[model samples]
Target chain A: MESKPISLMILDIVSILLLAVSTYLALVFAPLEAAMGAVQRVFYFHVATAWVGMLGFIAAGITGIVYLATKDLKWDIIEVAAVEISLVFFLITIVLGSIWARPVWNTWWTWDPRLTTAAIIELYYLAYFMLRQGIEEPGRRANFGAVYALLGAPTIPLTFMAIRLFRTIHPVVVGSESAEAQGGFNMTADMRTAFFFALFAFTVIFIDLLWNRIRLGNLQQKLEQLKLNILE
Target chain B: MSAQREKDQKPSAGFLNSVLAVARKDLAAELRSPELLLAMLVFALLAIFIFNFALDLEPALRSRVTSGVLWTTFAFSGTLGLNRSMAVEKENGCLDGLLLAPVDRAAIYFGKAISNLLFLLLLEVVVIPVYSLLYGINLFNPGLLLVVLLGSVGYIAVGTLLSGMAVQARTRDVLLPILQFPIILPMLIASIKASDGFLTGVGLEDAVPWIILLIIYDVIFLAIALMVFDYVVEE
Candidate 1:
């Protein structure tokens, strides 16, 4: 595998810098939330991580479809990279959400649809790895992974709808007219800046991590080929 | 021209016949041995018994918990049936034989799915009455039965596809449920909700959305399984 490009090094530095700034903004710049107090501050990182998670989820599905269509191993690697990054980001999202929920909802967990769906999505991706591990042949493994990824793609939206329809106590942060009325507070200007900056920071970090993981996958593939050649 | 006409008609007619043929083959094999059905039935009954002890089902609480218990048992036993059904094909080399046949690959998928669905429904038929006998609650609600049917369709549709892949893996049996459960959760949730509504004598308005969701899950998964089965079964 080639050395890390200069651009990626710059991205890594920028991402780290932005993450520090984003955290500072959330912790210090944003006004303390009236109802939930300091715990509500977790919302900035929570939503930003969830946003990055969603981005990875969509990328995985799209790359999965492309792999299936083109029969390209590169796309398979990209799909795996996307799913891995999404999995990590989503874990953060869920944990942060739970932390926020503890102070606000007076419980560590609630069966809110978003929470339930997020948990299920986490399990779904974990199962993706399990399925891949059980297959020895690379092509077949990639094929099954792509098919499973495609099958799981629809579940994300459907799961959200199912949970939303069932019932939801989780705050709808944006685009709901009754947000403020539903125990959800509107973001102040400073909070909005922190929130959007967090989102931007996480997107940059997700890309940097994904690029690094793809390189790792390429190296792993090369090593496997080398072993096969040596054995022959 | 006559030969071309016959060839054109053959595949279409052959498709349905091939599907039924595969289904019949599995049915006949199961009838001869009865291993798959017997195991699923026994396992399902054991699950219910375990649930009875685990939940400490008092008479008053049984009605409320019955839907959840029944679906859980079905889902667990369904995975067993799915794993075994596909494993049998792999063990006997029947999968390769089926692949070599002059039929659409999707027919094999439909055939396997139908057989798996039949096994689940049969288990439900016996288990429901047994559950009713044990709990003394009437389990013969049509609405609940419809939920069971739709839920099984949705479950088996995806289960068949996943098991087909799972049975090919090194960790064949252990992998199906892990691959299946998360994806099938929505259907399970909807089924349970619909079943509860029916059991509690809730109005149709409350249950209709769940029923609709079940149907949507069934149709969407069945279509996807058919489309993707070719890739799954490709050597």
Candidate 2:
């Protein structure tokens, strides 16, 4: 491996330290809900990961657009970096949400709008990778991947709205009619602080990971180009 | 490199005409053979039959589950038809012929999209009546038809574009569905919601938003597909 830059090393260290601090705050500093206890603490990291996931998602779409507009291979690398990190973070977010849901909602899964949207977004990212995997030429792979990424943008919001509307029309029935509001709980000031801090921490982590991934993509591109040059 | 010079020699308008001509040829061929349509229709029917036994849905349960079943069958059959259509083009060198045409790249995209939409709509129309007969459910609601149309349009619009790319891959046969299902999930969900709304006697007001969502999806994706089709088709 090539020697890493000092700034990148520092950013990586800072990311790990912040992630540790965020976990500490979420697990111990935040107050627990009366109904759910310790499991409710999962909400902080869950929301934070989701926040970063959305950031990556939107960034991928924007980079996709840029790639299409300028036909820039660099933007394609950036897009893939954002999407891969988003996929991993979103998976964690979904798992964490499920863990939290087990205690709070008394079920490990809910077809709730936000959760459903996250799941769809996860699938979208998966499809993005699959599209890239199928092509032999790097340029074609980047172009097709960029196209599909842009195509998926509107559908994500529509998916959220569809589930939301479906829920509103046919609320999840569990014995009583009005008891459907139990999933949401009020957050205390300390919980809010932890929650916001987790978001901030995850954002930093997302950026750091994205930059590393982009560098890795560049390295891979360089190796491919070198191999082509040696062959010719 | 020579292809560009050949393209430049022709008037752009003539190039567009040739693209439409290619679309027309596909449509006319499908009209004649009817094999594609017949296959899709029968596959859809088989899917519904399997679902009938699979779910064991009663009259009351069927009302809610019908949307899911219908969309599921449509999705699978849609992918099947998309694969066959694109694979045929690729196999016969029709796609390469189109690529060699002096037309805008988007012309190829639209041509495929139009023909794909035709096959999907044809199957949907046939399947609806069969579904009504099989289940004793009246599916003649105009609102329901509108939702079906919008959903198929959105589904096929993306399906056609993606399948073009998928057909070029090593895993051409299997890759289309794997790529299609996730991207089209929103359309499936939205269509299911709207179709269920119509089936259960829900008014237009209830289904309108889903239909609108489908329209917006179709338009946005169509634009994106047009913009990037050049890249996918580039040599």
Candidate 3:
């Protein structure tokens, strides 16, 4: 069996330390918002997590194209890792957005374009997984998955546009302030520090998680190959 | 109409003939059986009843949400038709036969999509009248009809490709909606909102944006289906 790579080990340690520092910066170092109170702190993590979700989104698109062009299974494994990670991060982004919205928007949910698109994106990820799972052959599975990923890539923008149009055409029923997302404040220096640090920290964490996931996928593929050999 | 004339066409003309031939094959098959259309109609009519009772759609609420109720029926029954349409081809070994033909795979896609669209439109032609009669809501507006045409086009475009892929999977019957609903939500949203605008006499200006959205969605997905159908149906 191959040992874990030293570079990955270093990344894992760095991610943990960065996360600890990031959380401290967000929770304590950042001054409280004058408007929405303490719940505003969730924005730091919320945006960061959303950023990671976008990474997954972009990764899924590139891997899909790369797989289709190259017809390689390796890209499919990487696609799955990117999707799984994006799925979890998107869920976190939604929950955190909801938490912030509860106090700020005075409701648990708002059909804001960005958040609604994120929700739809989560559905796309699950559908991708389900589509992959229903097929047994890796080659065909990857083909179908790659096709869906490519077809779905443009829909993120389309969904946002459609939903935003809907909001404009029909009144939100939830009054103007919440409806228009007019409830945010300009960040001071302290908040800016926390914000940038959170983004920086989460990027490292996302990279570390993606690397580990790709390693596991490769290992799983190897195991499947070994089982086939043993049976033969 | 003869084989000689069809063979005498240009490349693009041959492509059209191939598309029409495949479409004609499907239409002829459906005409012979008629079960797919009948089932979709019955399912859609039943959905109207369910939505009516479920919403207790009073005159006031009826006018407001009739577009939603109508599209909801179409969306559900549309999925039914899409699933059955592909599944029938797969089940009868007709899909393999189609693939073996000397034609572009995208022609196959357009052919399937066209037949599917016809069934959906025919279903709507009946259901809308029946629904309006049942609820006393006037639904014969031209704008709404235009919305229906574009909406079903958008639906069938991607739905055909997705169902083509779904029908090959082990859990194909259930896999399609899971795969389809989210992707088509934007299209549905556009369609429903546009229909609502027209139905309520909100004027052309109100519905144009949504109509544009539908057109954009249909064009993009049509192009996508053309590009990706080969992969979905590849052996």
Best by TM-score: 1
Note the residue pairs that clash in candidate 1. Answer: none
Say which docking band candidate 2 falls in. medium
Q: List the residue pairs that clash in candidate 2.
A: none
Q: Residue B156 in model 2: shift from native, Å? A: 1.5
How do these models rank on lDDT, best leading? 1, 3, 2
lDDT of 3 at B39: 95
* A84: Cα error in model 2, Å: 1.1
| Residue-level lDDT tens digits of model 2 in B90-125 | 999888888876676666788888888888988888
Separate DockQ for every predicted complex: 0.77, 0.62, 0.76
lDDT of 2 by residue, A1-232 (tens): 5877899989999999999999999998888778778887878887888788889989989999999788789999999999998899999999987887776677888777877888888877877787788788988888888887887677788777777775532123223444445656667888888888898899999989999999999999999999999999
lDDT of 2 at B143: 85
Model 1, span A108-189: residue lDDT tens: 8887778888899899999999999999999999999999999998777777777777556777777774332344888888
CAPRI grade of model 1: medium
Question: Judged by lDDT, which candidate is best?
Answer: 1
Fraction of native contacts (fnat) of each candidate: 0.73, 0.78, 0.82
Give the alpha carbon lDDT tens digit for every residue of B145-187 in model 3. 9999999998999899999999989999999989999889989
Ranking by TM-score: 1, 3, 2
